[model samples]
Target: MLSDDELLRYSRQILVQQIDVEGQLRLKQSRALIIGLGGLGSPVALYLAAAGVGELHLADFDTVDLTNLQRQIAHDTQSIGQSKVDSAMARLAAINPQIHLRAHRSALDADSLAAAVAAVDLVLDCSDNFATREAVNAACVAEGKPLVSGAAIRLEGQLSVFDPRRADSPCYHCLYGHGSEAELTCSEAGVVGPLVGLVGSLQALEALKLLAGFGEPLVGRLLLVDALGSRFRELRVKRDPACSVCGSAHG
Candidate 1:
């Protein structure tokens, strides 16, 4: 049941034909886990909280630094040096006290990750590292949970979802083939801040659609954005029978 305050807060979304009251209820009862607390994860966390996801489990081991001010919208000058989860939690709590926010101050390893994955209905892979992305993918596949993944670096961005609960959904590895061995940080190569916002906003949109059951999630297709060229390309992606994560499970 939505409180008087909830109905007032989410009225705009509820007014949509597809969402209405039932969709808002679904959002208020769902649990979502988001990995990473950087650029991509920042907006994903903020919007989901404001949208009233019942519970949000956020994971990130890093601390807020000066360089992140440009793109990591969840953190501000006041939050410098604090744990990313600590900073992000404060913001989300302020947005909608009706929503529950769980903050983890440290990174999750393969050993303890299963417990986190076990607690959520869906997972968002906003982690920028190769190893963590693979770990999150495996956990989602193992648990039959849907995943929304996005990335933005320089002037390029891409969004895709690996919904193993769907019969023909494609996993992350199927689109990227294999994780990159080269590591490039914004500190090194630099990035255009708004690029993260564009990609992160799209990620939030896809997540909302998945939660509300209103529109298509990016399960078997990938959208690549070339901000510099001012172009958008949609690539058709197919499940890899050899994909170790979704191969044997075969949803």
Candidate 2:
């Protein structure tokens, strides 16, 4: 049941034809886990918080640095020395004091990651490195949770969703495999600030669709954003039967 205040606060979203009172109620009952507090995580966290997700588990071990302000909009110059999780939590709380926000300032190991994913209704892979992304994906696959993954670098961004609970959805490992690649950091590769915003916003949209049960999500498709070319492209992704994370072999 929505309180009068709740209905008033979420009135605009509830007024939408697809989301009405029912969808708003769903948003108020959902929980989300967002890994990383960098550029991609910033908008993902902000939008999810504003959308009234019941709880948000934010995990990020890094501290805010001056270099991050360009794209990491959740942090400001005052947050330079603070933990990313703390900084994001403050911003999210200010957005909706009614929502619950949990901050995990330390790194999450495999066991902890699995536990976190299992507890949440959905997971957002806003992480930068392949190691964290792989670990997050594995946890989601093992727990049968939906994973919304986004990445941005050098004016390009990509977003995809993998629901291990879905029979045909592809896990991240199925697409990138466990192969090693040189790490790409925004500091080195130079990502446009708006590129991260665009990708993260798309991730939030996909998550909302999944949680609210409205539109079709980007379940088996990867949406690519080329900010430089000002174009968008999508690729259909299929689960690999040999995928170590969510394959028949794993079963």
Candidate 3:
């Protein structure tokens, strides 16, 4: 049951046949945990908040440094020295103060990470390091939660979603092998700001689709954006039977 103010707030989305009132209500009941409040996480948090996700659990141990201001649109110069979660909460609150905001100023460990993923309906892996990504993926797979993963380096970005609840979906380790290659992240490689925004927004879209139960979510497709070369390609990804995360029986 939508209140008068709720109807007005979500009128645009409700007008869409795919969404209507039901989808809007689903959005209001969704709880999303977003790890890493950096470039890729910025747009994801902003859009999800604006879309009215009932609760947001933001985890990031980093502070709002000057280097992050370029693409981390959720933070400003004033946010410097502030916890990333604090900065994100302020921005998300401004977007939709009606929602619940849970700010975690500390990094997520194994136990806390499990709790966060299990509590949320979905999780977003916005961390740059492969370690954090793997941790988030493992938690998602263990909890049978949908996970949205995105990344941007230099002028390239990639987006994918893995919902263990969906049998055909593949986890992150399925797409990217669990290798020990050193990652070239934005801080070291210098990313084009818009590229991060583009991919992060895509991550947000897939997350919203899953939350609202509308349209086909990006279950097993990897959408890549090569802004430098101005090329876009869709890569097919299949789950690994040997994947330790969501494989047949996790061995």
Candidate 4:
């Protein structure tokens, strides 16, 4: 049951016919894990926290650097050198004290990552690297959890959802079997701040839709954002039966 304050705080969201009181309650009971607290994770965490996702698990081993200020909105100048997880937790706590926040300050290895995914109802892969994305996808497939993945680099962004519980939905491995040999990080390629913010905000919206059972998620589609031209395109994606990570699990 929501407290009087919760009702008032989320009244605007609840008023939306698609996300009425029932959906708000569902949001209050869902637990989500957000991996990474950088550009994409920043907005993802903020919106989910504000929307009242009951428990949010924040995982990031990096620390705030001066360069992060341009895109990582969760941390400010005072947070330089502070752990990203700690910084994000502080920001999220301030946004909504009612929601629970968990921290994973250390880098998660295979076993730890599996454990983390197993503990959550859903996962948001705000991670930047291909390796981490593959690992998280494998973990989600093994744990039968839904994953909302988003990435932004330079002026381009992509967003998708993979639900292992659904037969037709493709896992990250299915989409990018072995990823690119030369994947670039934001620091290396440079990204526009608003590009990541846009992708992250979409990631958060997909999470809410999944958690609250309100709308269609990007389960079998990939949304591409071209910031330079301000164009949005979506491509249809399908599960790869031979996908090493999710093939046998789903089969």
Strongest candidate by TM-score = 4
Model 3 regions lying over 4 Å from their true place? 249-251
TM-score of each: 0.97, 0.97, 0.96, 0.99
Q: Clashing residue pairs in candidate 1, if any? A: none
- Residue 15 local lDDT, model 2: 91
- The TM-score of predicted model 2 comes to 0.97
Shift in Å, residue 74, candidate 1: 0.5
- In the range 177-224, model 3's lDDT, one tens digit per residue, is 774787776768899889989989999999989999999888899988
Off by more than 4 A, model 1: none
Residue 198 displacement in candidate 3 (angstroms): 0.5
lDDT values for all models: 0.88, 0.91, 0.89, 0.95
- lDDT winner: 4
Model 1 TM-score relative to the real fold: 0.97
Model 1's number of clashes is 0
lDDT of 4: 0.95
**Counted clashes in each candidate structure:** 0, 0, 0, 0
lDDT of 3: 0.89
Please write out the lDDT profile of model 1 over residues 157-181, one tens digit for every residue: 9999889888799887777666677
